[model samples]
Target: MDIKKITLFGRKDVKVYSDRPKNIQSILSNHLENLKDKEAIVTEEKTLTYLELDYYSSSIAAYLQKKCDVKKGDRIATIIGNRYHFPLLVFACAKLGAIMVPMNVKLSAEEMEYIINHSKIKVLVSEEKFISKVEDIRRRSTHVIPEEKNVFVIDGKNTFNKLIEPDYPLDSVTVDELDPAYILYTSGTTGRPKGAVITHINVIHSLINYQKIFQTHEDLKTLIAVPMFHVTGLVAQLLHLIYVGGTVYSMERYQNKKYIEYILKYKINFLFNVPTIFIMMSTEEEFKNSHFDFVKKVAFGGSPIYQQTFQMLKESFPNAELHNAYGATETTSPATLMPIKYPKSKVNSVGKPVPVADIKVVKENGEECRVNEIGELFIKGPMVIKEYWNNPEANEKNFTDGYWHSGDIGFMDEDGFVYVRDRKKDMINRGGEKIFSIEVEDVLKSHELITEAAVIGVPDEIYGERVKAFVVGRKLSESSIQKIKEHCQRHLAKYKIPEFFEVVDQLPRNASGKILKNKLKEIGRK
Candidate 1:
């Protein structure tokens, strides 16, 4: 199919097939039977067909319903890696109307405890690799203890060996479009993680947005390279592919060369990743020389894309399209997306809002700002979440007049493309992972030896950026750095861990005693 000629969105003649069912779960189940013999997911050596995915997901959902008492509206947390089973569990949970929460596997025990407790999660299904970590925190916190007696392990011995029979009559439950499908936790820039309650309509809205942005066709084969824990990974990539009956190449880990090899090997059309992944791929000589004949579009987000890097990508993938999408976990992935064709013209813009979503630049006083005026981005539509999970205080402060207050600083041009200036709050994007500096600093300050601490992001080549901690300590040394990190490892995720530590006599502060993080960034640059 000639992708360049495809300008408009949605299917003009979308003959809603007999196989395409009404509900999202039934959509997967129906498609699985329709694509029973067709290849659905491709790994390095294994290709799990639609039939296999259907069987496993059905079995898991059935097991959850019968054994684990995971009825409709119950919240289940998944702390597994990016594997086939992860999506399977996600789909299963969605099918039963259970809210699926995907935990950041790199998070420490204390961090996990905060989310588990805050969300009031029931049962947790994790990989064998992280069994010890999960078990260690299970007894420590009573936040989201399950009423279910048995905690069914994902890749463990008990009940994991059971194969789902196709003959088992699956009772399809009626699900409201507004019902919560998944609760993705955003990195709490101010405090603990806030669970963003994404509904079925929100997911559908996002997929429709993807269809509009990417111009999805029946032949589109997207690669699921991003972690399923993220909304982009689930709604933009996986669910979008399933909705269109397109193939998805799932990977457990993203080794740059190996991902490139798979792109060439399987002839993937759509590739989604962060700026870091694209930067690495662009620098590889082998990748520059390789023929990406079938690869049409490359979508990127989770961090800003530098102009230099964007120009390099244009020079490298001359034939391919690069899309710059912008959204929060609250907006069900992306409310705005830039066209792949006009990279140079729309340099720093995050494109325009998708068809169903409404975007506006608003001042601190809740009034809308004009074009090129920097203000907070406000979004209102089916895609936007109703509220933060169980946090009325946050909802009162963040959301107003039916628009989600995206804590990002950006403005729309005359053409309606958004240019992200900086984060309104101090939310750091180190590599693709989001690390709130304040969150990290709070953890570091918990140490008795540290009098004061401030965290800042410094420029990095591999991870896009790295975190640096500036401290005012009574006893600070190289050894103290390790101690601070060990302390942080207890409360924060691994990516949130500071890569560099600087012990200073006194932290640069304002007259009001506010630590000047900008000064720390400048000092770190030296």
Candidate 2:
């Protein structure tokens, strides 16, 4: 388990140190001591330096300890967006040894209720826009206190402003690195979201991964367009930036034009978002001629990127290093990253396993698959989460022998690069023929007329399941469909060709830009 050095960016070998801070609080305490006046966070409403952030978080921690009686291991949930309040609550929880549970703001009342009750959350904070949703959940869920005093809003009369006591002394608490710092719920494509228990050590390890792989340093300007609820934004962008004393500018929500404007206005040097955001921004008229000289690094994940979009980004940010990263909520943020100076010959790979992590492709019999053989991906490292919150069944099913079963189908090449094929559930079996949806989707996206594509399996009367594609395109004529079919025939097997094609103006996506294949499947059924 001793990691001495890590090779990153193709040639940079960075030393991996074992004597790091035990917890996030210690890390922040160091920053406060040395870089007190450095700007830490910038939002549309206000800016907070390291000193101010420490003061506000400690004040909030005092309020929670006195007013809410929050203690070590208590859960405080928030439905807020990417604002100063979210990070404030997070660090406050760390200081008080409370576990912060950040729920997705886009969830429906029922979904929110399920998570709130499932986690046994005590205090719930939300924004004014989502006040009604929280109210509805409070009525439905017994875990949430159905009183005005317990629920706080961001922009309304019921706010956290009154709880701030800048001069209040913070109670001393011993927090273990192994203690759970946050519980981030997975997207839960198939069922209810399961909270991934991310510990303080996991967060620190992921921060190290970002610092080593991306080569980030202090004073770096980053624009976080992704939601803070997701690991990509929380661990990779926000927390890492804070650890390095960098300035973070957050967007409440993503608008193609507004995102471009922020890049130009803030002179942001580091950009991290989903592939769909980049695709949309590259095609945006405003971004067509926008200068990207300020951008030094661009990192993308959550889903696959089309080859055409990758080429366009290369042309757009000719001076920037483009990285396609792969990880999950369970791994904190990134387990494998495509190197900054990656080989074009291995463009499809998600790069090698990070310094602190190990990856293996295994067959169903628990045996490791040979190189180039497609199988389930298993990841192991300190960065891998120890358990799922209150979900023993999921922990038992997903974790075994110090490795996390990723539930993703992929393979590693002889040179150690990983290429993901598809999620195990998304694979199609048509008349005993296995078809990977990602393969078909990749080929479909290569079509000149198609803007985006998602492939799914529809129930077939005789074949059990058949391939179907949902696409966003300019033309949907019979001739265009025929041309698409012909193109598939040239690139794919006869049985792998999509049996049905649905052309829509846009694909249904979640807040993270992951195509909701379940919604597509429901549409196919109807």
Candidate 3:
């Protein structure tokens, strides 16, 4: 509970939680002493206690160390989606002081191969379903681990069986809090993904930030529906619970029905997910009929929660506290969090900086912006990753001073709350007027008939670019389009309103529910 100013990772005067665990292993060890017998993980296949998870990971870690020659600071990659085995491998990596790179399951073989070669992954664990992609990568290139020896499968028979034989003792390894424990690749929506090297110091500060904001305890049980590849799933849901000695429930995939069933079946008390998941769930009859009064906390990010979805969640779980979180992989999952009380007046804001986070908004010309003036956000904190893995070009371009330039464009309110406008790349320029896509989309969503909205700029000869909007709602008719234009006219400026409107069933999204703007531009081209 002590805040201290100390030198960390060559940086002086950085804020950190004094007396924090020296490494990830130490934090797990402290929890194991009192919570060894408590339920640690619950999955569709089986439930594991803290003692069992520890035991299993020890045997697995010993196998990797003894057989694969995995030592401190080696990179271990997992392609198992969101199963129990994912967390099993996480603990296994933690025990060995190894860095984990949880591969994105939705990527093509070529994309996956790029990561394998880039990270130089020494060991790989994959699910039976995704083995073919691994085989393709193996056949196409010699840059990855061999299938006959170093590669292990989760639900298939292979050398993976030796990992659970119960004879290998997990030995201790000395690891510093500043040592890299994770390398999460960026979303790569723009180009090739770059890996963010996160240290144990980064992870510890992030865990403490969540703890201070949420006041989590050993009794807390949260369900994870997101993939482990993301910081939201790995650091926010899994590692945070491990640090608090709390229970975690895993969903191998996100399904609305299964989501309703799991929360009711497990008596889950906490929920963390993107806004799209909550929006999709609200439409189901099972969700509408359910009583989730037992849930105490709900946190959502990736996008702001709209008014309708926010109201639905409030009415469903009257006792729950809904908090908005704003973060990225480079920031160890949270840069800003909604205040503990979640004041309704600031519902649209992402809220204030986490205790350790220091943010500065800057203009395109690189000067600091005045309060309430929109610009890009640069974040500096002990929780922020020191640098990207193996990419000095990106490192030089993305960081300034000690802060990581979070390409997201937004502004800080007079009250210190942060409001994320949109990605800098998504902003539309018409003649000399600039329009943030989110501002236009937010106005469109305000219409009672519009369920969702996305905006993009299409090439135009007159203004260089023009606004286009994609809306989802009741089957579109000519009258509906006219009505939408009228609604937009009342709220948005003439320059900001879309020149084109396309009614679609749904917006394209990645596995994490982030809208794919690149795909939308392609559609706009046609």
Using TM-score, give the best candidate's number: 3
Task: Give the per-residue lDDT digits (tens) of candidate 2, residues 1-526.
Answer: 2465544212123334476678988767878877899888898888999898888999999888877788899889899998889888878999999999898899998888888888887788888898888777767665565356657788877577856766467788999988999999888887888899998988888888888888888858898888988888898889988887788899988888998998999889898888899988877888997878778888888898778878888888878898889999999989898877778988877888888787899998999999999999998777788788889899889986778899999999998999999988888999998898989998999998888999999998999998999888766655688899999999999999998998899999887788888899999887
- Residue 164 lDDT (model 3): 67
Q: What does candidate 3's lDDT look like per residue over 1-526, in tens digits? A: 8887776656567778887888877767787778889999989888889988888888899988888889999899888777778788888888899999888998888998988889988888887788899889878896575546778887767556777677766667888888999898887877899999999999989998888898888888999998878999888899999899999999888999999899999899989999889888887899988899999988899876777777878898899888889999999999998877856888889889998778999999999999999899999889989889999999999988777899999999888999998888998999989898988887888887788899999999999899999998875655698889988889989999898999999999987788999899999999
TM-score of 1: 0.76
Per-candidate Cα RMSD to the true structure, in Å, reads 11.6, 3.9, 1.5
Highest lDDT model number? 3
Residue 60 in model 2: lDDT? 90
**By descending TM-score, how would the candidates be arranged?**
3, 2, 1
Stretches of candidate 1 exceeding 4 Å from the true structure? 1-22, 29-34, 44-46, 142-149, 156-159, 163-168, 340-343, 427-526
- Rate residue 271 of model 3 by lDDT: 91
Q: Which regions of candidate 3 fall more than 4 Å away from where they truly are?
A: 477-479
**Location of the lowest summed lDDT over 10 successive residues in candidate 1:** 1-10
lDDT of 2 at 395: 83
Query: What are the Cα lDDT values of the candidates?
Result: 0.72, 0.85, 0.87
Clashing pairs in 3: none
